[model samples]
Target: MISLSLPSPAPPSFKPPNPNPKPHKPKTLKPSSSNPLHNRPIHHLDQAQLNKAISTLDLMSHHNSAADLLTYSLLLKSCIRFRNFELGKLLHKKLTNSGLELDSVLLNSLITLYSKSGDPVTASLVFEEMGERKRDLVSWSSLISCYANNDMEFEAIVKFIDMIELGFCPNEYSFCAVIKACSVKENVWIGKIILGFVIKSGFFDTDVCVGCALIDMFVNGGCDLESAKKVFDKMPERNAVTWTLMITRYMQMGQASDALELFLDMVVGGNAPDQFTFSGVISACAKLGMLSLGKQLHSQVIRLGLVSDVCVGCSLIDMYAKCMVDGTMVDSRRVFDGMSEHNVMSWTAIITGYVGTGGCDKEAIELFSEMICGQTIPNHFTFSAVLKACTNLSDLCLGEQVYTHAVKLGLASVNCVGNSLVSMYARCGWMENARKAFDILFEKNLVSYNAIVDGYAKNLDSDEAFKLYGQIEDTGFEVDIFTFASLLSGAASIGAIGVGTSKQLFKCLMK
Candidate 1:
């Protein structure tokens, strides 16, 4: 048992202590035979062994083996590496008890630990507690990255502004983080400013990663695909990831042919496409229903030995499903049956393709049953897809089961899930159940309102449809073309027109 001189640990408050707290210097201890870190090899150990080596709090204490700043930093990194929140908090206690004023390095370690552990609020507090002068490049970069990685994009941009106000030069990572913040918020104006900074920093031409992230930012953030293309075209070097992202973005932009053409260009340019690239190109082909191109990509997948990849297999299923010949999915089902492994995405793709295509609602429902009976947990999309099967079958019992399953999975409030529930019940002539589901919805989108109103109209319940219409009008939900179409259809169906009546009189007057 070793007793080390330590300052009193601060109260659990996160408030910044006096910046100039009285410093207590500990007397250096001789390496003891009982000390853990000194007893074994430290440098050659991997992260797991390193973690296990320092598992005990007393083992790494300041008095035991004369631990220094470097030792504490290494241990903090372990906390982050292992996502060990309790150990991180213990280190903070040890840090305060040791009376070492937490500087940028140690503070950044704390920020990284908390951020990786999924506690961005504490990371922000640690950063804010730093004195004005103590906020260094590492400090700014760590805090900004903390916000960005944790999905606090707006706060990340705010911190970047603060970093710039302090006259600290940002590195390429800082630019990447701020640019990602812009992408998340779709703030092209701010993204352009950050791009200009990156160019000024000379990272635009030299850093490949910076260029790739910028491409996503421009297209996704700026909503300007041409700008993204310009950035991709001018890059001094492009990797597989860059090509894959561009191809995926092209598909997202409705340029499926362009995505395939780019894939060809990549092969011609001598870049071997990876799983992600193949997945994107295959998906593009599926969207365009280009069976010939899809087959060609499939052959390439076989040649590249990617036939076993779950992503490529799922893409193939989607492509085969969409590229129908003679109005049957014989080829798609065959391919799906051949798959040796199936994940949640795999199940989801096939279920959606089955139900969404014409006249396969029964098959989709069966696949969903299999998915439920298997190890794969059905996601919200799976529930949504299977619920459409219920709509087509008009099985009130089945729809209710799906609704119950959705609630059990905590997806009852998801817009797609909730909308599908209303659609299912309405299609089944179960208007009472539909109304109850609609009322319990946490939030309603236009699709939800449309489904319910259309359900009422299709069930010949025009009164209920009009009642919901009036409610939604005051509720501030903007109606779309589908809404009017359903409403007019309901109105026309609710009354016969022009049987030598008022509509006939109006027609005669017009003539």
Candidate 2:
């Protein structure tokens, strides 16, 4: 063995004063041979390769101080990208230990990370801490944005108000967030207030995003046509979304003719109709029963190759079904069957169309059953159409079966479904069932009571019918022509002369 020269320990007098002596200057980490970029910020690294690089760096004990701070922050960002909260927590600990947790950029990143990871509590905590530490606008905006995007609308609004109170002006992004929140809650009043703020902030004219949100808010809030038109007219610029909203607003207000006229103007204005615009035009045509105009629009749709669109196709089917012509129903069925994707609305349109034509009850029922067999769940509208068909046909068995199914689907409480049920039972000579349905109604409307009373009167049960009529009167329900007709008929059937003196009840019908 090589003789290891054991250097004698330093002489007793030569004391090693304070073995762990503090350096005059803080000892800075030198660049490691393993890492040439150790002194540089890790944010400069390719984010895609960050995970593997971080793992390798973890194994290496020697790392530059500044590089460690930067690398840990970048690594936290990567963890956020992957939504790996566990990894983020570990990196957070590292950042805290490295004295970078209070870093504004790092805290902002962490806030966004927690928000995106669906950890709003943590995001909120980090945000509060950031504010306590005097962070910048970006940090504030990040937390507000996270709250808004996370569907914490109330929280987001509070944060926005807080931000404003803090003398921090919101950017366009902040306005968009609050506007979207108002839109979601359908709080048009607040939305209008925000619009005023947006205008005062000078964000409305330059920001298309803010403009779009404003238009959406007005339209969705059931704003009047004049209000919507004013907004549209005043817009310095318009996009496809703006035109679509305007068309939709007209359609919703039952101004189908105006909607069609606007659509033509849009075409003349050289804005090509997108699928949504065509769908709106088609719906207007259907409502007007304007088969001729509807067909013209259909031609345009085909030319634009939008016939395959589910919404447009459904509208086309509806329009054709409403056509007064004999073979128009065939066209409706053709459109329906040809649809590559048939949702509940497709089936509903065809069934309602068949019911409207007065001899296709059997076909309507078959289509409804086929919808169920095709694994397409029937909605309230579907049941309503089928029930109407059953009422027209006086198919008691089918009507009751549909009622059972409606109950199974938890749609029996839907007003339309309940009305249809009462009508079907009354028309099918099941007065007891009709009364039961009427009784179960949470809201007893005049039409519903009238339905039951009229059923009894039609069946020549004047006494029972009169009792219901009295009940309706007791409830302060206004007697309409139908009510009077049913009452007069009931009294006349029973030879009660007093009912005839109730004022020219049948005069409207006579006229």
Would you list the clashing residue pairs of candidate 1? none
Q: Which lDDT tens digits does candidate 2 get at residues 1-511?
A: 1111112222345534765555564343333334555533342335355555555554443544243555666677777877777767766765665544367878888888887878888888887776555667777777877877787877877888888897888898788777776665356678778888998999887887777667666766545567667767777676566777788888887899888777767666766667898899889988887877788778767766678898898889888877768754889888887888888878887888888888889999999989899999999988988999999988889898998999999999887888889998888888888889988987777888778888887777877886887787789877788887886786677666464534444442353
Off by over 4 Å in 1: 1-54, 58-72, 78-103, 132-134, 184-186, 326-330, 463-481, 496-511
> What TM-score, over all chains together, does every model reach?
0.80, 0.66
Q: Would you give me the overall lDDT of model 1?
A: 0.78
Per-residue lDDT of model 1, residues 1-511, tens digit only: 2111212222355644654366665433333345566533243233256445454435555445544565667667777777777877887877777766666788889988887877899988888898776778887888888888888888999999988987888887788878878885457788888888888888888887788878888777666789999989978788788889889999888999889888778777777688788899889989988888788778777766677788988898899889987677777777677788888988998998898787999989889889889968988888988888888887878888887988898988888898899888887878898888888888888888999999887777766776787776878887777876676676578673334334432432343
lDDT of each: 0.78, 0.75
Highest TM-score: give the candidate number: 1
> Against the correct fold, how does model 2 do in TM-score?
0.66
